[model samples]
Target: MNKINELSYNIKIRNTLYFEAAIGLSGNSFLLLFQVFKFIRGQRPRLTDPPIILLALIHLLMLLVMSLVASDIFMPGKRWSDSTCKFVMFLYRFFRSLSLCATSLLSILQAITLSPRNSCLAKFKHKSPYHMLGCLLFLSIFYSSISSPLIKYIAAIPNLTSPGFIYITQSCCLVPISYSVWNTFYTLFTLRDVIFVGLMAISSAYMVTFLYRHKKQSQFLHSTNRSLKSSPEHRATQSILCLMSFFVVMYTLDSVISYLRNPSNDPIFYFIVILVGHSYASVSPFLVLSTEKHVIHILKCYGRTVDI
Candidate 1:
């Protein structure tokens, strides 16, 4: 009885954390999409513009879908039927696969951006923006295709034997890790991706620091000249660096929590993991919008106009 009670408490904590994370991520994604849309409309839409924007939009949608699933599966007195639960479970798996693909592409882009001019990826940098756009699209499609098959095992079914908990109502149906080898492979793959992401983050930070120093030196040298200012590349680099930094920080925390979790069962840990994961998507948009000087200026101007 004590063990059961402890489990119940853990499960409740886990669900609450997951719900909060989902809500936060959803909010961030929404804000990112809005900022992207506004930027595209207000400025010229480039070849590289669509995929990240689309990804953000898709992620936002998935967050909403997941929220509905969570409510139906986890919330008491509002549980979904088997069929509905199953559908939501499938959708969550499908979207999660796509999200991973999208994130992978984003990481690759960051790596390419930082690669040396002599590197193979440098060739892509010189390609027309349209070509870069095509590359991103192609890469996204290939990654998504590779991951699609993995979603089939996911299901949303009630835990008839254990009546009280929510996550049990519907959970991802992963293929049984029948062998230690498979588990090892899975761990390696996850580690590889994390390493790649870490490299990208490091490169981004290096570039930002380099740019900052360069800017300072240039300003000092040209102190007397009023005409010389930071270039567009500097501005764009700053923005991208800021975005990457935010993603890296949030994702690192999420990954750490997930890594610490026991796969067998630990609801409180699961809840915290979910909360962190979801919070990123929702908060990202606001971060982008708030950080952009032009957007802030526009908002201030609008306020003044309204006052007038």
Candidate 2:
């Protein structure tokens, strides 16, 4: 009975992962293809469009890699070889880092776009694409240089029933490292997360301030008018703010759960952590697309054509 229950639980987890991956892949793919079509058609892209494209692509790849990892983690019987485990995990980590950097850049880009002409951030408006590219390059280098230890430490579990192996997944485990080494890597990873999250928070605050000042100014100018609709830039900023807020919440929850987890190697705990960690990648495209009028317009046109 116990064995049967465990099998059922694993099956449920696997199904949940499959569902999440499918939804994320479809959303991200649609967003990506739409943006690509815009570029191909020589349409003028918004300042935030490039980052959105990059972000969609990043999340798409991350979800794909995550789906692969989930297959190894939940499927029983055949185990991933050592090389397969290392490669898949390394890809996941690489894309994960890119996601963080891209999100931070997205928020900052939105803030720059919404800045008043005389504001300090206005100067960055024209140079945002270059800056974003440079930042992503730097971040990729940083991840390769600082987080490369993960490649060394991650290995396929030689024996599933071994007593000394640390549980990462059913097939992969982290080999033991010295306390000093572990502390060094832990601190570096934590610091990286802190820096990106801090950037996001700062950018979000700036956007909020701009929106508040704009609202007050508009109110004073058009006294007693209650129907002043927000501008496109304002709507975009709000969307990015919402996305950043959700990302921070998910990040904090995942971090806290990881920090507080016991060594009992609970499968449920692992699934929760994974779900929290992947939530942003799986959900962000919809958050972004919700504010994109272009996608809606295109869909409407397509529907009309279909009905004809």
Candidate 3:
């Protein structure tokens, strides 16, 4: 009886954590969706171009579905049907795969953007942005389709024999060693991408520093003259810095939590990992929208105009 009670307690805790994380992610999705709409309406620059916008939209939809699943798990006497649970689990796997593909595409785009004129990627700069978007879409779709078959293996069965496993209705994960190996490889590849992101962040910081130094030197050189006007590059650099900061902070938190978690048996660690992962999606839209001056200006203008 005591062991059964402990199992129930752990399940409750895990479900609560999942629900909270889902709520947080859902909120983030809404914010990002609004920002995307505003960008489409010309209120803000499309920071995420067409390919990224499509990826974000897909991610938003997945989060909404996950939020529903999490809620069902948390609410008493409202557990999802076996088929529904299996479907949600499949969606989760699919979305995770898609997220990874999208992130890789984003990294490639950034690499191209930063490439020198003499480099191979330079040829892409002259190509239309739509062409790049098409290429990214193709890559993501190909990878996702290749991974889709893994979802069919997932099944939900009643747990009548196990004490600690009763809460798990769907068995939707890859075989343990295989999954771990794949995860390790994926993490290695993502580490390379993370290094690239870190490089971007460092370069952005350097650019900001250079800009400040230039402004300071100009002020000293032309004392009593008018202050230097900010150039468009300066503004773009600032915006990029804001974006970089958000990525660094959130990714750092995720890395730290991931390192601390032992994925095999510790439900608490798993809960924390999920929470940290979902928190990033929730905060991402606000980071992009609120940090941009034009978006803030548009919001202010809209507020005043509506008050009139």
Candidate 4:
């Protein structure tokens, strides 16, 4: 108890955290609906479609995760009970992992969708949705539940701590587990990142290669004025590229911070980590939605009908 008290430090909750969370939640939730609309109103309705469905699920999970973390920030006080702290930590970790997995899976699916007939990834396109959904379910259950029992954390219990510990009591923290059991949780998370991030990087590069090889042929076959950018597939590929770019940047920054993370480290570092981590979720929908030409078509139709 004394050692735990010595390690705990007071964390100050700032107003910016709440503001970012609120705006992100509102924007993502609304655009998530628009994503669904895009799917439902498509020329061909696909109830079992993996690409559209997985994308929506990713945004939905991102929104839910932002809600959980933000709601905790806005609580009346920094102090939380054992169960509450554990719950917060669990939801945060589990959902964040799922979001990354889904995003990586999305890039792979996009590449497969755009692949040539003979490409290896093309065969898996039809089955990707089921596999992605199943993986999401498995990760959610495994991450959320498995860590609860082994959870080791320190809460700021000012009233219960020794007098010497009274000065710095502020918030609860989910402490790291020992190396003896690291293989079960930490190792899995590391491998997951290595695999998914590698897949996303490789697949994205493959897409670029495919596009480059096809571009000249496409231009020669079509009109000189025909732009590859006019295609829906091209637009989607660009948007997904932007999303992954943002994710990579943030993930890199967060990794650096984690390497430097320590009990005596500045709270601002943690704040920066949280802010950058959520930026992808907050801004990705708008970035992706902007690429959809259907919105423009619908608006033009409405204007013409009104004018008539």
Best by lDDT: 2
Q: Which portions of model 2 show Cα errors greater than 4 Å?
A: 128-131, 160-162, 223-230, 297-308
Q: Write down the TM-score for model 1.
A: 0.67
lDDT of 3 by residue, 1-308 (tens): 99787568766865775566555466556555765676677853332354455555656766666555444433334445556656787676566555545544454554455456897866866665566666656655655555455445444444443332323333323222366755765665466446555655555555566567867888878763243333433444454456556656766787787556453545555555556655545554555455455666888999999999
> Model 1 over residues 1-308: C-alpha lDDT tens digits?
99788657656764675656565575556556565666767875433345456557766767777566454433434545545655665666556545554554554555556556887877766554445556556654654454344444334433543332323333433334346755665566576556557656666766666566776877878763232233434444555566667767777787787666554444445455556666656665565455455666878999999999
In angstroms, give how far residue 243 of model 4 lies from its true place: 1.2
- The lDDT per prediction is 0.57, 0.82, 0.55, 0.63
Q: Which candidate is the best by TM-score?
A: 2
Could you give candidate 4's per-residue lDDT for residues 1-308 as a string of tens digits? 86454234322344565567666666667665766675677755322245445555565566566555544443335566766655656666666766776777678777877887787766865563566677656645654455455445434344554532211114444454456665666566566577768988998898888778778777778755246778878777887888788889888887776656555434455557677777776776676667778766876899999999
Worst 10 residues of 2 by lDDT: 223-232
Cα RMSD to the true fold for all candidates: 5.6, 2.7, 6.1, 6.4
Q: What is the lDDT of residue 257 in candidate 4?
A: 68
Worst 10 residues of 1 by lDDT: 161-170
Which portions of model 4 miss their true places by more than 4 Å? 1-13, 45-78, 127-132, 138-171, 175-188, 219-222, 225-227, 265-267, 296-308
Candidate 2, residue 284: the lDDT equals 94
For candidate 1, give the lDDT.
0.57
Error of 3 at 215 (Å): 7.1
What order do candidates take by TM-score, descending?
A: 2, 4, 1, 3
